[model samples]
Target chain A: MSHSYEHPRPALAVDCVVFGLDENGLQVLLVERGVAPFKGRTALPGGFVRLDETLEEAARRELEEETGLGAKVFLEQLYTFGDLHRDPRERVVSVAYYALVKLSDHRVRAATDASAAAWFRLGDKPQLPFDHEQILRVAKARLQAKVRYQPLGFELLPPRFTLAQLQSLYEAVLEKPVDKRNFRKKILSMELLEETGEREEGVSHRAARLYRFDRKRYVALEKAGVNFEL
Target chain B: MSHSYEHPRPALAVDCVVFGLDENGLQVLLVERGVAPFKGRTALPGGFVRLDETLEEAARRELEEETGLGAKVFLEQLYTFGDLHRDPRERVVSVAYYALVKLSDHRVRAATDASAAAWFRLGDKPQLPFDHEQILRVAKARLQAKVRYQPLGFELLPPRFTLAQLQSLYEAVLEKPVDKRNFRKKILSMELLEETGEREEGVSHRAARLYRFDRKRYVALEKAGVNFEL
Candidate 1:
């Protein structure tokens, strides 16, 4: 038996830009490709989409298969790249996605089709294969703009974090120094964070009080048309 | 000659959600389909992708072919839809794009493959075919969110427009009433609009002053880290 369609078809694939934050600053995950066409070259973790799954599922599966990362994170569809010569093998269309994960939670480990996996600081990073570099740049721009209007930046922080840690996350993503007093006053007025009734466990200086993001309150406030700006 | 590959591929297509603004309010361009799958049903102007053209080119071509609208407009890729059951005949993946045009500039007329073409109020649209309703909803949400931060609403208005016209564009897209004095004060403070030194013509009442969007100034201000928030 055979199936026939006259026109040529472009192969579809999914690529992910996974971002994580730590004391060092914002970072992106890259995997060393273990197969041709760009074998041994560092690139985003992704692969051709299977016949049975949605684009989001394909992104999640590819991220875990190449980098040993978990599927639980803040994931979003960023953009689709369909440049004629983007892939060397054939005409391929890639649906790109961006994911945010807490650095302290997911340890980096290479697996399956990746020779090595590691996090690279946003500014200082290895040369990428194909169009992964462009995709990463787009994701960074989106993160920078979105962080100013949405609360997704909290996804990069720990469950219990100090106000200083939260402010640092914003600074790292936005690449700008926010006024300490103004930042504190604005975020606190939104009332999206709750006192965790605890302090930083281990630090060289006096520990500061920790707080947790109030997801329920945030959802209610968002429904009531509250704009979250920092 | 024939090419052989063993894997199944989804048929690729492009759909456009073309938005225009007028005295009636925000409107979308819809065409009465002349072919099947949904024969005679009203849907967005679009068609399958050709092997030679890029996704954007395909979108522009389809828009012009289905409706007699010109190819000059502000076009942007919205999202990709690939539900397995979206097309009854076969698996299809659609790359959706949204375009903004001035209603007065483009007098729409049905052409080659459409039975009829017309602009319908966004809220009072006819029943659409093949998941197009969902695509339009996404486009509307994107437009509403984007209008608050960007100067895209100008694309919907005439080149020289009055402050009242600009405010109405925002109100129609946002589906909410904006305070007249506040809207003018905020928009004027940005200094992105330049006075044209002319007034609207052929009106029974006093003519209002007209202004032009300063694209060059907006670009410079954006590069200098100016935020265009309303």
Candidate 2:
């Protein structure tokens, strides 16, 4: 409801922290601002939530308009920031969202609205504006925690991936090396992966069988509270 | 940054899903509405955000004003609700806050502005206004998940409690019975509790030693990524 007081309303904005996984490690999508505020600074892709759409829709639209990403992807609300003076001009409350996508599948290309949009290793991201660095940290923690309890880690992997690739995704997100035998035993015991009878084509060493996350079982187990710890 | 679209600005409100633990089990504070829209209907304690106050401040103030609870309590931003038709008179975007308080410390007393304010067992709570039911569910799940990693669960327990009481708190929140031996082993290993050199009174059987949570150690261990899981 509009505040019926003397003070002005805080400007509401929605920002997207897009996460992608690649051969190097976990990465975050960054866009160089083209606006007056932090004109040249690189930050999470986002904009004001328009009157016509919901918060999620605004995030997706902003992601698409700023990074050429699509709405038909995994999107979850990370948190909302309303600390006074977070923005220099006025009180701006931002609803932050975190998204996971396969870097191999959705390549980053600068959109017309942004100076540049690129994927940077999360550990090596540039300084962001308006407490975005903290927002990104929360998003990363959410991703790490969610991966251990949900099959959502697959969102950062290709449709068909090796068990090693999946394991690496978990390691990269958790920021800790997992015991190979223990990780495999725990994950395989979940019975949520489907072997496609295919093997890695370009690797020189032993070929690992390609597997896809079983969406049906993943949803069922998610509802049943099955912790998918790596 | 108000929207320039044809529609008028929607009203914004803040609701609190205050959770407290007592002999009755997990409970939430509810207030009977005194205004029109949902007059006399029992709902979450909330009100319109003032122009000068931040969303959090608004939440905290509204919570206390409507329930007679004070600040400096365990409060966290739960989620935002913005369904267009959720509010009948207008489109009200609510920032919901979830608070954990020891029921023994602050008993719910009807506020001057509320028809009545009281504690209701979460599972037996009546239908709340707007999407408060959904917000309450999210609040409970967040509490359950957070209890594993954060020491905030102690907010729901008495200042001095027995091992059995502590274990029962975890069981009630987690909704799963835990082995007493395992529970005691894990919790005592934290070394974050101080024995009061006393035991629970008024019990017919053996009295258990009472312990108080060590806030200093909890704050330190929290930074070290120590989790208080069952």
Number of the predicted model whose TM-score against the real structure is largest: 1
Q: Write candidate 1's Cα lDDT for B74-137 as tens digits.
A: 8999999877778778778889999999888765343233448788898798888899999999
- What DockQ class does candidate 1 belong to? acceptable
Docking class of 2: acceptable
A86-174, model 1: which lDDT tens digit per residue? 88888788889999998887653532234477888988888898899899999999999889889998899989999999999999998
Q: What is the TM-score of each candidate against the true structure?
A: 0.94, 0.91
Candidate 2 — which residues are off by over 4 angstroms? A1-7, A108-115, B1-9, B108-115, B202-205
- Model 1 residue runs over 4 Å out of place are A1-4, A108-115, B1-3, B108-115
lDDT value, residue A21 of candidate 2: 86
CA lDDT scores, all candidates in order: 0.87, 0.82
Best by DockQ: 1
